[model samples]
Target: MKKEILNCEKARSICIVQTLAKLGHFPNRKSEKEAWFLSPLRSETQASFKVSLKLNRWYDHGAGIGGNVIDLVCLIKQCSIKEALHLLNDESIPFTTEAPVSYPDNSGIEILSVKKLQHPALLDYLKSRGIDYKIASRYCYEVNYTCKGKKYFAIGLQNRSGGYELRNKFYKNGSSPKDISLFKTNQTSLIICEGLFDLLSLLSYSPTLATIHDFLVLNSVAYIKRTTKLLTDYKAIYLYLDRDNAGRKATQYLLTQNPHCKDMSNLYEGFNDLNDWWLFQKQQSG
Candidate 1:
């Protein structure tokens, strides 16, 4: 019965934005990727909660929690996961899989090859970022692909959705299913980074730190809403976002939701980001 319920939840996973609308909670603002709504979880006048149309996930910024359709139902209905599934199964509530959501098309991007990160260009790129090739290899690869009829290659870091976030000296992009990359250590604490390079820089700075705490890399700040759901299980969340406006806002948003969230950006003060700070240190020391 549990297996059947889980399968049903996966198969009938509904678009959360539509669900919100059905609940009479329309978004105040929306875009191609996400929608912002006044959080239904609490009495918030400001629309801080958001729903990712492509990912079919919702994050309640006020509550610092998020999840899939089942999780959302569970929260709103104050029921168990099993009860949430039952509620979703009711005929009165409509859950359709036909809604069109704007997501990146990966069909144009063909991964021609993937191998060890031994390419000199990629190694040099890592060196330029002050990240060790050895550490990078553990989490990244040399990916050769063609997109829009042009051939390209880069260091690829795979996200939880099985898509690659590619980076190099000249290109920074990702394949379809853009999602977060979670490195779990079975620990209660987590270090959240805004980009893959920052995660790599931290690992390179202290290899032992990887063993003590987990890490989450959001390929883009646009996914910060989706991140709130993943962070609920952790007792501590350390933010290492960029020093830019978007990064600062995201950090403040998360800190508002999760009081335990600590700002680690101070460690790299005066630099644009963690990787930039690490590179500057390496250049000065060398």
Candidate 2:
């Protein structure tokens, strides 16, 4: 079979509805139209999933999964360029499935120009995402790209390799390594969270912790190997994984491997992560 190139617009149109329907944005004229079912992806109880044929959308409250037609196709078919187009063309599925024509993959693409760190458009996106560009600038830079004669810029983290860890207003790319900050404070206290946001939230809320506590942000749980040895050194390491399944699993796995470490998830039991807990506190205060 010949390789299939996708028409971008068609694929996008086809995917938007499916994603919207899955996200429960679909309009339901009647109670029956709000049909509910168990999530098809993960095993769970309760019919949190709903479909809105009238609005041509779907939503699953339990999983927090929502998107448009193109996103749904990407999730369902594990889309490649050709597959995305093919799925869009199939009328058996709801909504139009057409996408702009995609060019061949140039995997070994090289950098053309590096963008300015303080570009107004770039800074605006960072502000919207709750990231301070001043802080982000310490670790990331910007780069420019051209597609079909259009110019765009992206912020990127420098990797060990010369290539950048690229992220833009729309997307993020590359991998972030697990980073652990160790301090031997007399208080014998330590904290751990999944990402920088959570750590910053914790620091912002707990002024008392500034005295003698060390912290770590396991960039990816997969990098746990780099952290296992460091856990042994801390007198009371706090496992502050997210409240989601991945977070719970990491905490559980760490306890199994290093029983001496303390689990800090109890500090924010109801919420998903440290940042979530902060948001909760912010809401409660208001």
Candidate 3:
């Protein structure tokens, strides 16, 4: 038998819909569960893109297409199912078998727990991530709570379930588990990155590339096993992994798996990734 997929709650917690909405997609509104936005699928005027907050669903009035959260991300991002969850961290959502209830009791839920975050603290945390306050404020919030005998902070994102995704701002780097986000549009070229931050950081360095080529964030070396298939479909593949041992190993492994995989590591041999390389270049120029 095949391994069972995680629940809706778990899926919702990690999905980046909230972030995407806040960044530029969904407009902020209260009372109504539906949100209006410019259709990401196509450019049009008059805000035909609609997202349902209560149902955690979305629809493009212009395109006459509508779907739940998962459907929207898959279409918007053009990623595989596994890669989609990895990109959005949709696995962060939490759910149980119990029937619908007014309030959920989040005592020992794993992954990201939204019940522990402080509202103001979360806003501050987003600022630290270099995400604009106004943008983040539109989608994220801090959940109120006291856990055990001590107080804990969590970043809350709305979900199909009543719970939120909670990640502490102070966790050790690389301590958290890794996930991959892969996308392959019909474009002729492919651009890869080490992680989500690095991928997003690329937007700052090469804004044009963001729209011109299909992008993939390996999320980690572990995901390379599942990425070879994506390689076969693209005409050109670029490896933008880190300069460290793990990144090198991943890049080499990919080449071995698919002869088409290119070692673009030369572009950032000095730094860990494009972002670091860009930052270093900025310092040198200054």
Tens digit of lDDT per residue, candidate 2, span 1-286? 7555557665554434345453334333337445555543233455665666565465554433444455455443434445656656654556333332232312112356765587888788665545555556644577765432344567755433254444555533332221333334555656767655565566667656656776665544555556787677767877778888867888888888877777878888888878778777777785
**Clash number by candidate, in order:** 0, 38, 13
lDDT string, candidate 3, 101-163, tens digits: 222232222232333323676656554554444433433455543332234455544432343
Candidate 3 achieves a global lDDT of 0.55
Looking at model 3, residue 57 earns an lDDT score of: 69
lDDT of 1 by residue, 115-223 (tens): 9998888999998888988889988999987664557888999889887888887555566666888988699999999888999998888888887898898887778
Runs with alpha carbons beyond 4 Å of true place in candidate 3: 1-169, 172-178, 282-286
* Sort order, TM-score high to low: 1, 2, 3
